[model samples]
Target: MVAMTAAVGARPARAAPSAARLRAWGRGAVGAVILVAIILQAGAAPFVRGLAAVSVPSVVAALLLTAAATAAAAWRWRILAGRLGLALTWPQAVSAYYRSQFLNTVLPGGVVGDVHRAVSHGRSVSQVAQASRAVVAERTAGQVVQIGLAVMVLVALGMSAYAPAVGIVLLAVVVACAGVVVAAAVSTRARDVVHRELDAVRTAFGTVGTVAKVVVASLVVVAGHVATFVVACLAVGVDAPPQRLAAVALIAVLAASIPFNIGGWGPREGAAAWAFTSAGLGAATGLAASTAFGVLAMIAVAPGAAVAAASAFHRRRATRAAAVEESS
Candidate 1:
């Protein structure tokens, strides 16, 4: 009996790590499948061709747009953090956001950078939960606003004219979101978290001035992203109308937000292919455009590399100083 109890007690310690490994494996598998599907459907030609089309001008535009978007995103984070009673400055938010974006672009699973950002920020504040919530709230706001803008664009362009399926997809998404809300309401733990987060969101963005600022910032970020996509499309000789391209760009952006991706690949390419094809353009054009956009996006986040390097250097210096003090 004593042996059995000891074995049972030890099981949890081993099980936790095993479960985490399984989850990581599952995510990797999903990402691989997504990449395989894109290659199978679109082939590797478009990616290679798009790379050759990248120009110095396009690279410059991407860098500029990325800076604007990052600044807007950081501002939004600052607003939310302040509302949550966390100490955050614009400069800190901007630097952290850049580092996070760089990490997101280079790391697998697409969200590792966000996870790091939340944990690091939380640790600094000594209110880990609140800090994490702030990140969540900021990202959630951006997504909601992005979706809203997409819907408005689709509606304005008349969904039936460009793509009837988009309207159906939007409806399905709304229903799914409603279902999730209902499910959360029925579950005790989920309901508590939902209510708590909702309260936090309200507190952070409740005021008229704050809400306006957040919405405007979100719009700017979305516009910058869409513009970059447009630039990428132009670079690849995609001659679609600006309005049509904007709509498709929004769809691709929304798709890129899917977490089942390898370093921000997968769904983005898949969605771009689908969106462009549905808009009466060839799938290859979509793939090429998306590929260019991906490259440009990476270029835009290059500043993050410097930020990361500086951070590492500072840490090393601090460690060395601490060692010297200890020895003395």
Candidate 2:
């Protein structure tokens, strides 16, 4: 029985890399190229110096806000899970989220964390698929919020003084995204498919209290991200206004979502620098803020180290117990 169980569990674990894996690898390569481009454009010395000179208070503030941001993320996940009928406690969701974030930073593709979350909940394949779709929806909502916030911040900061060319480019992106969303939503087949799955859809949407609560929480999450960036700015002595914080925050979030540069190191910093420069701020300041934020985030993730250790120990003990049982 034990041998059979082991066989069923193990199978032949050959590495069958899929098309998706190949694409992810390609994206990683593109990310590396982006890093090289940023390095060439920005010059290496100023970047390094900017990262090195961050102060203590900024670090503290960034860490605090980072924790809040992580909590907000867990809250979002909880809402999604509840919608899917797989309810997890806040503490459980938060711990698992932190571990997932750690994995995204340390492991390849980052999608593995999604798989981990799905399997950890002991969900069926269809449930996992629905849950994964909801995660993507949540992410889309956050990005929409980020873009809106960035635009508002730009207007508020009077960064409109920059070349009209940039504004045109931004307008084009907005139009393109709007068009894509509209096209998808307006398709009768698409609407029918979505309506057909109303049960799952309603369940997913119902997890959170109301749309207003979700919106409010999303705002708080965005605010937390901006606060973290502002703290990083203070640490690095950037002296920018609260409005400018949105640029850095938006860029950081967008770049980090792209799978590359071990925990978002290269792209995050580079994109931040570009965002700052476009906002009429020095690239050094953006680089500094990005570096400080990254450092504080890594520190915030330290608890996940303990969680990982505990999980490993539990697995080992379970294995040993199974061995004893099999022998008996």
Which candidate comes out best when scored by lDDT? 1
* C-alpha RMSD values across all candidates: 6.8, 7.2
What is candidate 1's TM-score against the reference?
A: 0.86
Candidate 2 yields a Cα-based lDDT of: 0.61
lDDT of each: 0.77, 0.61
Clashes of each: 0, 0
**lDDT tens digits, residues 29-101, model 1?**
6776987888887689999878987999999999999999999999999998998999987878999999988
**Model 1 lDDT vs. the true structure?**
0.77
**lDDT measured at residue 3 in model 1 versus the true structure, 0 to 100:** 15
